[model samples]
Target: DQTSKTSYDLVVIGARWTGAVGEYWRSKTTYEVIKTIQPPVLVAIGEREQLKRFLVCTGGKEFIEQAVQFTGRLAAAVNASVTLLHVMAEPPAVYADMVRLEENVDQLLESKSELGTNLRRQKRELERLRVSADVRLRHGIVIDQVFEEAREGDYDLIVTGTSQARGLLRHYIMGDLTRSILNRAIVPVLVARAGPAKPGRTLWKAIKGLVRTR
Candidate 1:
């Protein structure tokens, strides 16, 4: 009943794998905690430093906007650079050539597609907060593509979002995907949520107020 009863502004956990035998159970427990939590989670794996470059992952899913909004506010705080990344899964061989998954952000924006439109909306949202972000596209398995991009881009932080469905349904939906990213990511991963869980509270309003006052 914790997921149904409690909420938080943020849930932060440290990550340090010793490569021991017991690390398996430790990882499993961490994943469970992440899936059940109702707010954003930050899995910190290394030393804390100034976050200069942020890689925000967007799949046009539930919390993409929230993730971008939060990132924009945080970036504004330190005057950091932001990059919006959208990853496409490898296509079937039959349609591989037609998909042209290699198309970059600029090329995609020129076309009329849902993904392009979503990216534009997210970019505009960042612009509203006075943060200009670079848009990038990749093709492969979601997690793999993200890892590759993180290494190639040398980003300081990785921001991703998932559905906030609770209990059993949540486990089947995005638990693995979210957990996997946190487990393997070399940089800190900010798992953004739709909003606060309880009524009479709005995370966006609080963030906006902070940004304005800054």
Candidate 2:
């Protein structure tokens, strides 16, 4: 007997860094991060279908595997695709310096060699992950680019990491990228806790386990 496939249910945005890390570290394992969020149930049962998509916004190799895992699981259950976006926001001066360094590669052979090696490593990683993904890198402000992509791509959901606000004034003002994105995003947003782990019972439990083992 052929099992019927479940319809697509959700779309997840910003899967690369914060969302990936949060999903990996969270104790709950059943949650599926997709590119969009659909109603829990549809009117038609057998013929009903929902196409979910997940957009992963990444800058580097950090937490990419976790994002892929989440997307793969969701896609297996329902038709879905993972889109990876990389934003390079280095200032124009930095870009010029890189250009100059490239031009002087013969003069600075050692330094240029190291830089080339690092760039190759990054490219290799990106290539490996991009095998099953739509990957693109752009240069601009991260939040602006993310918002623009979401709008242009017609994403339905956004998953992102959120860091705790520091300082009384800043906290009150919500003067942070996470807050800015949350405020401006038109679709549903999942804000993952991106702060340092709090020292709590888990620490004590680990200490006790060590003591017992000793």
Candidate 3:
């Protein structure tokens, strides 16, 4: 048997899913592939030739550029409706923190001068591309909220992109979020990483100190 295999430069599957969104991909997963084939998780809902609705998940600035450009280009190409979703998670705590977090989330979502400015900028960029889009803000568990919205609406694909340049803290925390969404999402999750897949092991440590130390 040919034991050696190369990474998938781009793998687009059909709409038909045997089980969960990533189950098919997961079942076929290999340690070799998983290590090197890490890319942004862009989840496609159903098997269709053209996308009708696309969901762009944004919050962190690291991935926003890739997220916006990719979403805009794809939406304009297919003339799909874009829903820019930013899921704000309540701070982890009890009564006081919960209430405060809720209030803060409310403020950001309600105030035109807050998150609204960012959303407007996003809208303007898409408008320049001639791809009309609407902004949506939701509060709760980030992954849960995203899934709930995906189910309620007719989103054809879910676009989530971010990069943290291999940090210790980020690896344990934010890494889980991305992995969880990819594993659990009923829709397609696109996690965009900018680079080519390599032939060696995936997690090759290159950084000597904390990124913030500099």
Candidate 4:
């Protein structure tokens, strides 16, 4: 329930065998299970056994901690390089900022201040695990910018987060950006869940899973 103090990412798990949402929705009679789960469920469509590079999508502080920790652990496990990316979504026309003549909209919305602070926090977290990564800033639609970076970098995986949005507002936030990336990405996208486990637990679990799988 939204009223609960516990925080975790809300994920809608469907059949791995099918990409069609309509078909997957019919997997169970109940849909409320999306809100609660004991262990995080991970589904990876990409078949890579070794991770080399990562493209992490961020939205300032909105990017969940679990995702950042998971990404760092995975990178440490495989000696992978990571690139943190943040896209400044186009602003409304009324308070319109400067736009590039060739591109749709190009302007600064304190991407440096917001994304900069986040970059430092994440890098510090990664440093605790001895994982160093690069940071990149871009401008445009969030989903589109992410996909483009993924394509250009040929990242082994795309690690991102989904907010625990509730009610009708959720419809506008959680499903759109993540689902869009999931739909078009050729690599695996790990949806980082929030709450519990802490960073230490997350890394320990990932190392164990890697051992078992590899």
Q: Which candidate ranks first by lDDT, i.e. highest?
A: 1
lDDT on C-alpha atoms for all candidate structures: 0.73, 0.44, 0.59, 0.60
TM-score of 2: 0.43
TM-score ranking from best to worst?
Answer: 1, 3, 4, 2
For model 4, how does the per-residue alpha-carbon lDDT over 92-150 read when each residue is reduced to its tens digit? 67545433421331223324554455666776687788876776777787888898888
List candidate 4 segments past 4 Å from native. 1-35, 91-112, 165-173, 195-214
TM-score to native of every candidate shown: 0.73, 0.43, 0.61, 0.60
Error of 4 at 114 (Å): 3.4
Give me the displacement of residue 104 in model 3, in angstroms: 12
Residue 42 error, candidate 3, Å? 4.8
For model 1, state the Cα shift of residue 111 in Å: 3.2
Error of 4 at 18 (Å): 8.2
- For residues 31-75, what per-residue lDDT tens digits would candidate 2 score against the true structure? 221111221211111111344554555433333343344444544
What are the candidates' C-alpha RMSDs?
A: 10.9, 13.8, 8.4, 14.2
Per-residue lDDT of candidate 3, residues 1-214 (tens digit): 1223655434343233666434535443421233334433344534545568878777724336555766787789878888888877665466666455434643544556545566667767888899988777677888898888888886877776545445443221135556666666666656654321123443434343445467
Comparison by lDDT, 1 against 2, better one: 1
Pairs with backbone N, CA or C atoms under 3 Å apart (clashes), candidate 4: none
Candidate no. 4 TM-score: 0.60
Q: What is the model-wide C-alpha lDDT for candidate 3? A: 0.59
